[model samples]
Target: MKKKIYNILSVCLFALLVSACYDDEGNYDYHEISTINTEGLEKSYTKTSYQDVLHLEPTVTATGGESDFEYLWTLNLTKGSGTTSNKIEIILDTIGTDRVLDFPVNIKQGFYDLTFRVTNKSNKLETYQVMSLSVVTKFSEGFYLLKDMGNSTDVDLHASDNSLVDNIFLKMDGEHMPDAPVSLGLDPGYCFVDETTAEYVITKALTVCTEKDVRISNIEDMSTIYTHSNMFLGGEAPEEKPYYVWRNAYGVGYISDKGAYFSTQASLWDLLGTGKFGFPAMVNDDEETKPNRNGVFASTCFYYLDELKGRFLFLDYNGSLHTYSDLDENNEEKPNKPNGITHHLKFFGKNYMDKKSTGYALFEDENTAGKHYIYQLVLGMDPFNPIEKVTEVATSSKLNGANLFAVNELTAKVMYFVNDNQLYMYDLVQNTEELLRPTDMATGEEITYISNRYWSGSDNADKNFDYLVFATRKDGKYKVYLYEILGGKPYGKPVRVLEGEGKVVKMHYVDPSMSMVSYSYFPNSF
Candidate 1:
């Protein structure tokens, strides 16, 4: 009887093993998908900007396949002479027979062909479909001015065609910004997008609104591109204060009460945090982490000030952020770098002279023995290792209380800074300062803001007719003055006078060659 029981147990164990093998075999079926078809599919789409998502949902039908199958959707962007593959892939999790594929597409203005691949238990099949997408914006070629009109802010566009459109935001969308406009960040019209095209953008701040508090618009028609209306308004205002905004080569990067945040040209106000939207943080885990992206301003020559870290950061071409100390380890100048902890860092946006150069300048604050000395950083060296060049240019306590600073290639190595209504010229080469008092203008009207071709194209490559535009306020009115600098001084009386512009708080000149030379101002109270 015991031998009989052993024989039965052995037979039962063998049967169990065979059953497991059969189930495993079933996982690999010999099914094949046949006659896959897509219905009600659109072959072409119109996309306004990179932020606009093109929704494509097509009904799919397949026959002669397993009851359920996996789906994959892919879009291959055409690069080079339409030979290279710029692929974006998405996989569907759920298995299905007859289904609809929901795909959202965001890419630069170009053409792309999409494909869908289906996989069954044992067989794989792919279907190819070609489609065309067109993207165009009115802000592509123009000079844009974002104005604050107490109740609501508006935008003005001076198109390349010499046509001026006033309050274009309202004309395009029938809406104004959230509140009174505080600050505006405009690209100096650099073609960071491609060799032939540039996407001009405008970033502005509002007074009263919180959610969707910041607005970024396209310069083509002053149409709204992206708004940080709901998502980012909860954090502390990043501008350190309202009416102040920070910008880089292509996007608006500012320190919010929350943290450092930035958005790109293609993606207006996504408000990407560090390492989130491919933004190269000054410090990251690895240098080879992210890909070089074309979303920001100048990939090679953009610098930003991190007030929280008390350090100046440079964004390299390959989506990496580095400081002067982080550039080269063996450099002798690395040791003399300022201790961000011991000394305070005061950064002036757009204060440096050359916007297109590899280096910029700033004031290093030192506190000792109840006396303070302001050191001017005339960084003329490259960020990466090469030859040892001059970095720190000048230092003086007399250059304090400077509210406005600007640099340009036309002025050669000279820099201009405004302190308490007095305009002082600091020669970065000679290491000297000259105070020039205006002869005829408004008394007690100190220079509130100053702008020039510093932020113009190619670091002042087109400096032949470059002029310095300054703003002053007196008797509740704002006046803009333009002076041509010859022999390192204001050559003549204000060549251009734009009087009666109410409360001219900020000013910038688009390269005259790029757009018709026009300036727009906002009223004190609208």
Candidate 2:
């Protein structure tokens, strides 16, 4: 009986060993799983004003008829002129019945044909559908203005490449309101609150005020008038406050909304006031009180003096011209004065206290009286004063309130005001002015002084008029006009570029190279 039991035990042990060996044999070492079956593979292309990263779908199947599997995916850029080596390899450690691999590719603007291949443990071969993605980069070349729709206080930028003009009404928190709106000045890149927290955030990302009716003030009232009613108020008005103006240089920088800065003559009261009132205010002054009292007084309008230097010149209300460089250190404590280098050019009219005084002086060079009745001072040196000279190029009658822009370093141009409906191009070298009429300037009855400022472009180096963009009032509405500047002359007639449903406030050329135009509009206050 003992022998029989031992035999049974030995047989049982042998059988168990055999079973283990069989199991080991069943486990196959696969160099490559069969071709992986790729699912959720798709490709598409699009164009946007900004650069964007795209994500592809999660890869699904890597079937190779095996219980356990591994996956390796390779992206092959078969066709493209750019760096064709744009490829990625994804090694999937987890592969099962329900497991799916994910692959992502960053596609830029262009055409591309992409192929995705996957390998699995069983060496099974499967290919995802070849995706032909043609991403056409779409961009609008014209200028854009971003603004807050609710309180009309938050101004920002919106650019378009095409010619279609649309009114961009700011809505609080990304809500669009066509009725209640604030028009922007011009395209000045993005907009944001001049605060530490918001820093350089785009204007659209800001929180909109739930209530409106903040007092709105013009550029002039910010300094002398300390009352709230004198200011343009948006957002919620404080309850029965002491009528104190915020005094916080809130909306006082370059009007990115209008593509310009405030240039107003500083009043004597403002010069002695407690707050910094102008664009290039006094640099050294008490922060708690007012700062910087030696610069141009407010009474100027902002002008893009030079693109290369990125400096803006403005005329102070004191009849002086000041240049403010965007590349300046900004201090929140004393917010009025720009912390960068500030140049001042006082343009005391031939005689103060004479409203009709025609002549002016370049205070920076010499305070001497000059014979030329300087109606306007375009900052930067001209033939008269070659090195950093401020040229008195236009008279009030010729340019009127028409915005002055630098056609080039040596020459300044202005859209002529009144019925002549022409552009006055002044040659600093020749000391001459040329009249460029795309057509008859719209009649005075059609537009107002505050209508959209004239717009044009000049390639000073080439001595060629690049393009001319302007706006006119028609049927109590503002319309945009585009004219190509060819061979130092305008061609054909002005083509209607954009027509909007609101009152046009300002228009600007995006660049001197293109025919694009950016315009701003506000609703009619009927």
Candidate 3:
């Protein structure tokens, strides 16, 4: 009886299906939507200057309802949104509505995601191609001017393109600096392979310092990474004022209260304090260990002359401090030397081209107090040996009142000095001097700063000696002048003159090496 009921139900279902097939009155049709195949779009576009046009012309192919289509080009910034690798797009601008783009890239210099979209108006179908774009500017590199505005200090950029960005700290940080600017430290990490551990290392960054505050800013984007309290490993800077801050191939170094401190090749990334600095560079200033007004740095160490002891001291790359002996065992001038003591030696960053422990040193006579002498220095490769050369320059009329000095890196023999309003070039080879003064002094203007710094990070080899840089102040107004060096001397007048609102304390050429990336400590991260 169950088998008979099951057969009856199956027959009823089959009859219903047959009846439905015969009663069908519907039509099925197929349509082809527009398709777009875009070509000539590179995977990425990078490193274009700000003044150039975005000349992008791509070959686009379409089919089906291609005749009726609309085009749109949009730029968006893709940002990571959570812990995952997923990204969220923030549309920056709708650049164009045409198939070809001849638009000027007027956006800020940075990385952006570009999207080209094409839609078939008839079918409402859309197709897109995305690309990565990187924008840069010529204005990113050039001279940096530290301007002293009476009560405060700030930075300005005289860009490579001859454009000036005034008050860069305020423009980028959205406010004034924590304190007045003190000095600029640029370390373009010169990567080296450590022989002992067979490890490669590069710790690079730019340090902008003030009297009481230190700010570490990223050179890549000119962004503030760590400032003031966060920059110090101790959480707070030393109560004593910092006289100098500098970065070189080895590490970041600074001088505070006559003592120099170094942070070995440590970076801001990976962890804190690795790039942070601590401890006063080794100094036994019996009389308060008073270091000189300024000091110089080697590739592996920073050097200073103690005003109290009148000896040379060095802080190595490992954060260890040492003093190179400048005396004989007898405590008297060595037979091979005269006035062998470094008591009156003052440093002016003279080791612009030394790959070892050698360069020029300036000496002052204790007898003729205000006078100075230029000497050759080779403190020896090791601490045990003292082999050096000193230039015993007599106190002459030309050398008198020579307060400012700038060594010419090209010749290594030309020294530019200023006396009152007069500028003189002293040739060390011939021991002769030439007066470079304008000779038409109306109001007395005093010269303030002069330097011939070596730009090790620059591809231009002669960057150090190519210009004669100096500053002058009179009646509260300041002028920073740069003269092109021809032969071994500057032009009759400055090729470029930058007027400052207050005193122009220092000027430096910002080079490519100063910019440090997020250099990974892990070898695999490279």
C-alpha RMSD (angstroms) for model 1: 17.5
Model 2 gets an lDDT of 0.31
Whole-model lDDT per candidate: 0.44, 0.31, 0.59
Q: Which candidate order results from sorting by TM-score in descending order? A: 3, 1, 2
Runs in model 2 lying further than 4 Å from the true structure: 1-44, 47-167, 170-282, 285-387, 390-422, 439-466, 487-489, 508-526
Query: Model 1 off-target regions past 4 Å?
Result: 1-183, 187-212, 230-282, 286-299, 326-335, 338-341, 349-360, 364-398, 438-440, 454-464, 510-526
In candidate 3, the residue pairs with backbone N, CA or C atoms under 3 Å apart (3 or more residues apart, or in different chains) clash, namely 188-513, 260-281, 285-289
For every candidate structure, what is the RMSD over all alpha carbons to the true structure, in angstroms?
Answer: 17.5, 16.8, 12.5
Best by TM-score: 3
Residue-level lDDT of model 1, residues 251-316, one tens digit each, is 434333333334453222222221112222446643321211101123223444444554555554
**Which is better, 2 or 3, measured by TM-score?**
3
| Error of model 1, residue 86, in angstroms | 12
Sort by lDDT, top down from the best: 3, 1, 2
Give Cα distance to truth, residue 305, candidate 3, Å: 1.5
